[model samples]
Target chain A: MRILLTSVFVDDQAKALHFYTEVLGFVKKHDVPVGEKDRWLTVVSPEEPGGTELLLEPLGHPAARTYRDALVEDGIPLAQFTVDDVWAEYERLRGLGVRFTQEPLEAGPVTTAVLDDTCGNLIQIATQPE
Target chain B: MADDLFKALADPTRRTIIDELAEQSGQTLFEICSRLSMKHRLGISRQAVSQHLAVLEAAGLVETRREGRYKFHDLNTAPLRLIVERWLVPRTSEPEENTP
Candidate 1:
């Protein structure tokens, strides 16, 4: 499936946006008003450009808030994103001073890695044979 | 809202439908059929689209609100968010990338 966007709900919108766009280098696609103290924001990979969108959902809704908290409490990751050149992408992010939780490693046919999002999640970057 | 959204988005047809409904209010089955046909060059019948829509709706990825003569299908974010959160846990460390 062509994933248009991936959404991560966080408590602080400002911090989430800073980490995702500034640190990770995901270009912002949208930043609009949605609700009180909430904004509908999105980003995408520079390689694919506008191919897919990454939604930075604010965590304040009772459902989203509870779910985010519970998942953090359980120490679970929300999701992962695929990159064409994972090793290159890993190094690029590393140069940007981005901290990684798991270093890049070959897992069978797929080369995978993980990073601490600092938003209470570990985002996985990988390249796998479809 | 990534994995479940990705899982919900796993199918090209459904992803196309989401892209179609990206900004618009909503659409009926007939409208969906025409748009998907012209856009994706799909030769599938309306029945096929209906079946696909059923999967989307059943997964809570899409919602159907009753309108006059047809059911207006609108995308739902709640299910996508919930499912992604649920999938965060490995659930006993199953093999990764087993399914698309």
Candidate 2:
């Protein structure tokens, strides 16, 4: 019944790890070898280590590439992360050379911004009303 | 070309799309759709929005650009110049009629 994990298809696990951990400030939660060239890598927010885990699943299926590419082309984010302040996070990420497809926009009660994940996906960060 | 421009601007939804694009150029189709639904309360489908963009593209009011793996939609008001030139400019020059 509980949502334990979610996934995003990454083009490269190594690069995704660096971006997710070093840049986006997530900590590695799991890194088990799956096969000869693949690993079951996952990362969790530093704020919530026991919370939901984000699996940086590899782009194994050919269809995943087409799907990701089409979504990226149209600036559709595969996943969304909640942030305390979208504008602050957007500025911080942009300072680190992260390219944003959409800037921070206030729509009704929520504010959001979209950034390129560099691992072939767009990620949206938002701040929702409490 | 003018027919296409006028037709593109004739719809309320398309005009709202223009208004959003004018606020910020170079947006993705997803962003545009998000704005329409979230900001403007437009509940149209993505396919319908895409079709509207195609109509706007044909009218030169919108231009799309490819940047690496991403494609962005940019608003181009150049075609709107035809509207000003077609009617507004001529009326301004004929002010002598009212001077009498």
Candidate 3:
């Protein structure tokens, strides 16, 4: 009845695992080998380790590349993740050499910033008013 | 298959159409067009709506059936539910002794 998992297609699983876990601060929840070259890798936010999982699914299909490329070219974020503090998280990520497509911007009740996930995805970090 | 499903859903217009269908399932092309325009305030053409529906049908998010001259489109939420069950469903019943 609730959202349990969502996925963002990645070009490389190893690089994505490092960025998502080490830099983005999520914890590896699952990493089961699916085939010879791919794994069912997933990560969850540290704050909600038992909550929703983000699957770092492989971008193996030809259409996936085109879809990701189009979204990136149009400057649309691939996914949005909620954070407690947008500016602080943006600063910390920037310090880690993560390239941002959009700086922190406050719009109405939410503040948001978009950064490249380094795996063919532009991820957005946001903070909503309580 | 999942990639194509996601790709089909990636479009805003297509998402809106899906929303419209969710609101009222088993709608014909004309009914979908009218509802989209009146309810959602989307002034998209019939051809555009048809194309989006085609994509949704291909993704298995929608199914179509012909009743005489009219083709009715129904929302198929099975694929979406399958995705959730595949990764989200907790395997609490299974032993977790292998955890590292």
Please provide TM-scores, in order, for all candidate models, with all chains considered together.
Answer: 0.48, 0.94, 0.57
A best-first ranking of the candidates according to their TM-score comes to: 2, 3, 1
lDDT over C-alpha atoms for residue A75 of model 2:
92
Best by lDDT: 2
**Candidate 3 residue-wise lDDT, A2-110, digit = tens:** 9999999998999999999999999999999998999999999888889999999999999999988766653467788999999999999999999775567554467
Per-model TM-score (chain A alone): 0.77, 0.98, 0.97
Score candidate 1 by TM-score against the native: 0.48
How big is the positional error of residue B100 in model 1, measured in Å on the Cα after superposition? Answer: 52
Candidate number with greatest TM-score: 2
Docking band of candidate 1: incorrect
Decreasing lDDT order of the candidates: 2, 3, 1
lDDT of each: 0.68, 0.94, 0.80
Question: Residue A129 of candidate 2: its Cα lDDT?
Answer: 77
lDDT score at residue B59, model 2, on the 0-100 scale: 95
Winner by TM-score between candidate 3 and candidate 1: 3
Residues B1-100, candidate 2: write the lDDT tens digits.
8788889999999999999999999999999999999999999999999999999999999999999988899999999987877667855454332112
Candidate 1 error regions (>4 Å): A1-3, A62-76, B1-100
